[model samples]
Target: MDERLSVAPVVPRFAAAIREVAAVTAFYAGGSIGSGDYRPGISDLDLVAVIAAPLTRARRDRLRSLHRTLGVAKLHCAYVSLPDISDVSRKHVNWAHERMFRRPLSGISRAELHQFGVTVYGPSPAELVPQIGREELATAARAELRGYWTGAVRRARVWRTDLHVDLGLTTVSRAGVTIETGRLITKREAIDRLPALGVPDDLTDEIRRRRAGEPVELTEPQIRARAVVARALMREQLTRLLG
Candidate 1:
């Protein structure tokens, strides 16, 4: 632990909380914490755990309480059943504080889990997650670029926030890189490579400034323009591949 892990100070408490969950067999950390790129007050702790089965309402509520007690600002702990760890076809439901959603672990997530994700409890993530092929990852990345992100930008009605500027930059840059190379890069790496990703310097600076907790505002027009530009960049990379 580099001590930057938001949960590091509370690992014992986190450990205590997980142990209380009788269903949790294995827990692996992900996101920035997994990559050791944690930015104080910015990067949240991401955890993926294998459970005996789908967490019951009582168990879910109990786990949520632990997060409050732990006092970690952003903790994303998702649960996959023991049988579902290797079931790539199965969509797993994970609980992030209050939200419960279905999203199968992506190849990028697997790469990080296996390469650097720390085990909070139970077995190693490598033992639980199967190896993912780069081709498969590339395919998925392309699909996301064409579908989710293309829609994501257009649907956004808000800007000038940390999530709108800083988070958006990371996702766009990461998606662009992954679509082209099928490799997962850290958030910092994504920022550093934004120029090569065809991101305009103004937008890049927007992310940097927002990340530093500066107060910045972008008009609705500016936000929409940034979204269009990002989508265009992605489409360009996507086009070159086919050409």
Candidate 2:
């Protein structure tokens, strides 16, 4: 890949909504889409900015422009207020993000995000993460790998098999999790490692259920239930990559 083509910082054209968000915000981290390693057909200009307040019109506009200029890699971005940094829900969001985006633009980094993880809703900035221990991380990796494999299986039903393949590839590649076979490992090989991390059989069942298009199903009102399943699966996959 030519360095010129790599996500060089371009002045983003944004709407007033996006500009408002960018101007007032104290960005923790963000940069060119797909600031990390490059993979064919799998890159996006992603941004993660932490602000002190809700985004305004200009902010939203700029975000869109940033993506458009960044090209087909699809621009992914997140905006969170400083207070939102410590919120539980926000923490979960950040936790999930860590798996998918460990490396950021050259100027942006994940260290700050991880710092937020250890001090959710707390004042201390120096507190060490006793919970995100080695064992915990290892467990997370296994679960996440399972998530990637299972997600691949289920998404294959709704989307094309190639998309599922791309999902697994993108997730793993983004997470920077090393696999001896790179991206070509078989499905069984992928699932085999997940149980060691404490992922329940129920998850596998759900993946299978969705893939099989089972008769027993939840209605639209039960969307929350559906999300729960997806979230769990995401956790497993994200954890594997980011953990």
lDDT of 1 by residue, 1-243 (tens): 434345355543565577657377877777777677766666676777778887777977776666566666566666777777776657776656456567777666777787668777677877777877878777766655565545544554443344654555576677667666767888888888777767788877877776656767878787678767765665555455433
For lDDT, the strongest prediction is 1
TM-score of each: 0.78, 0.39
Q: What is the lDDT of every predicted structure here?
A: 0.67, 0.37
Compose the digit string of candidate 2's lDDT tens values, residues 1-243.
Answer: 224233333313321234443543432222222223322334333445555565456654554555454453444445555554443223311112223222212111232233321211223322321223334334443555664465544442432232342244334442333332222222233344434444455544543343334544445644444444444555555555544
Among these predictions, the greatest TM-score belongs to 1
Q: Which regions of candidate 1 fall more than 4 Å away from where they truly are?
A: 1-8, 64-72, 156-162, 217-243
Q: What is the number of backbone collisions in each predicted candidate, taken in the order shown?
A: 0, 27
User: What TM-score does candidate 2 reach?
Assistant: 0.39
